[model samples]
Target: MFDKLTRTFSDVLRQVSGKSSISEKNIQDAVEEIKIALLEADVNLRVVRRFVNHTIEEARGEKVLRSVNPGQQFIKIVHDRMVNLLGSETEGLQLKGPDTLSPILFMGLQGSGKTTTCAKLALRLKKEGRKPLLVAADLVRPAAVKQLQLLGEQTGVPVFAVEGEKKPVKVVKQALSFAKKNSFNTMIVDTSGRMHLDDDLMKEIQEINSVLKPVEGLLVADAMTGQQAVEIAKEFNERVGITGVILSKFDSDTRGGAALSLKSVTKKPIKYVGVGEKIDELEQFHPDRMASRILGMGDVVSLVEKAQETIQEEEAEELQKKLQSSTFTLQDYLEQFTRIKKMGSLQSLVEMIPGMKGNIDEDALNSKEMKKEEAIILSMTLQERHNHRIIGPSRRKRIASGSGTSVFDVNRLLKKFDKMRLMMKKMTKNKKLQAQMLSQFNGNI
Candidate 1:
């Protein structure tokens, strides 16, 4: 996500890092580079101009040019402006919480993933111990109701849809009554949309809004749509009054113009972003964290939060023990891969590591190489997994045949495992290096 923009910023900052002192020409050159990067990312032209002007004015200030570390100071100025451009701070759903109606109305153009985003929001609320009801108010689109209901069942969230009621307002009324009777604290209404903005679609959404009186009117915009998304958001806010935005299909948006342009254009914060197709892949948008990620600083906080969700305490302790004892094996390696897969794509994880963004090819991570590695381990015997040393040439050939791979593949796996073991042993035995690593891990660096 935002890989191209991140790389551009990285290149400009890398140049600044080599500067002996900040000069007028230095700031001018850097700002020019930034302008080109933003324009290439498809950011709103007005927003990019304002950004360049603001950055240039600040970078030229005495406080920045005379700073002990001028490069770091200039970076801070740009980060602050980007944060402001992205929304000065994180904003959440304006729900009262408890026995209230708590209607969260979702609206967007057709094919914006609004239905799935509605289900994702319901799942999130359900996980937070709130009883959420999914209201399928998208009566215009054929099978939209059925789609929402299927997603609701899959996510273990209840759905309310009145059969044969073509009127979305009527369906929502029934859903509200259902929620009230069932004591549901949250209600998410999936509204109808058209291929493009139209009077009929806007009127239907406005009527739905009037009936639901939602606590949050969220527009589900596709980040891939670029500036058109910003325009959609503005029109929605003007016509139906959206409270926030949910950037759907954001994980696939490499340029990231919509995410950076939406807030500035609509004056609405992006409350959530759809990171993947899964129901659990929705993430709350954080301005500071996104700013850090955009600047190649990585989002360690989000990485740790993701790990907390996927890794258990005892499992981590057991992995630590294995590392310390130098007892890691093929089984452990396979298990590690499975865990990382659960968290997200390997490329996304790599992007979250500081200085490694845009350096990994996502296709490479998803290629036959990963599958072959897993297959080779699965073909190995239990004893072979515990002690790979017993696997000779004949055993390697058998394992390769069993795994539908070549003998060379087996050899490659063994060599990689040997390198990993050596690295673990080297790190565990070096006390000073271990201390330095601990300090860095603890953010002392």
Candidate 2:
């Protein structure tokens, strides 16, 4: 996600990395490259101009001129400005009260992933101890209600849909009654979307807003739409007063223009982002972390949160013990991969590791490789997994044939596993190394 923008920033920074001092000419050249990069990524022209101008003005300061490391100073200025452009702070949904119902109406265009995001939010809320009722108010699109209903079933949330109900307002009205009777604390209304932002769509959303008085009228914009997402957000905010944005397809947006420009254009923070298609992939947006990632700095906090959410404490403890003893088996190694898979895609997980953010090769961490590793491990016998030392060439050939791979592939995997065990042993004993690893996200190389 945002791979292009990150590469652009990293490239621009590299040109100035070893400079003794940042001259005006150096600043100009770097800013010009950044401007082109932003424009190429389809960032809003105004946002690009403001960001470049702010960065130039700040870089000319005496603090940077007299700094020991001018390159780090330049990085700080750009990181801060990017954070401001992306919304300086994180903002969550504005719910009415703890005891009252807060209806969140999702609005966007067709194919914007609004309905799926609605279910993601409902599932997140349910996990947080909120009884959420999914209201299928999107009556315009064919099977929109059924889509939301299926997602609700997958997420273990109740869906409020009236069969043959074509009126969105009426559906929401009955959903409200049902929610209140059943003691649901929140109602997520998957409102209708259009092929384009038409007057009828606006008016219908307005009616839903007026009737339900939704606590949050969120526009679910597709980040892959580039600058058009900014325009859509502006129109939505103008016509229907959307409180925030939920950027869908964020994980697939390589350019990152919409996520950067939407907050500035709409004057509304992005409350959440759809990181993947899974119901558990919607994440609360954090501006600082996002800024960090865009500048080739990793987001360790988000990474840690993802780990804690996916890995059980006891499981983590047992894994740590195994690693410390240098007794981690192939079974433990495969389990580690499984746990990491639960966190997210390998590409995304690599981006969270501090120094590894801009440095990971997509082909190297490809999901196909992950699947192959799993297959090889699964093909091994219990004895082979327990003690890899017992697997000689014949055992390796057997495992390779069983896993549909060659003998060389099995050898490569065993080599990697051996290196990993050594690294784990070192990490367990080396406090300074562990601290250095943990501090990788401080934004100073």
Off by over 4 Å in 1: 359-367, 428-431, 434-445
Error of 2 at 230 (Å): 1.1
Query: Candidate 1 residues 1-445, lDDT tens each?
Result: 7888889898888789666688999999999989998999999999999999999989999978888889878888988999999998999888885867688899999999999999998898888888899998888899999999899889999889888887989988888888999899899999898999999999999998898898889999998898999999999999999999999998995699998899888889999999999888899999988987897767778888889888999998888778878898888988987888788877777777766676666676774788899999999999999999999999999999999999999999999999988888788778999998656544410
Q: Please report how far candidate 2 places residue 136 from its true position, in Å.
A: 0.9
- Top model number, lDDT: 1
What's the TM for model 2? 0.95
As a whole number from 0 to 100, the lDDT of residue 251 in candidate 1 is: 92
Give lDDT tens digits, candidate 2, residues 264-342.
Answer: 8889999999999888999999999888878777788898899998788998888888899988999988888878878
Root-mean-square deviation per candidate = 2.0, 1.7
RMSD of candidate 2 to true structure, Å: 1.7
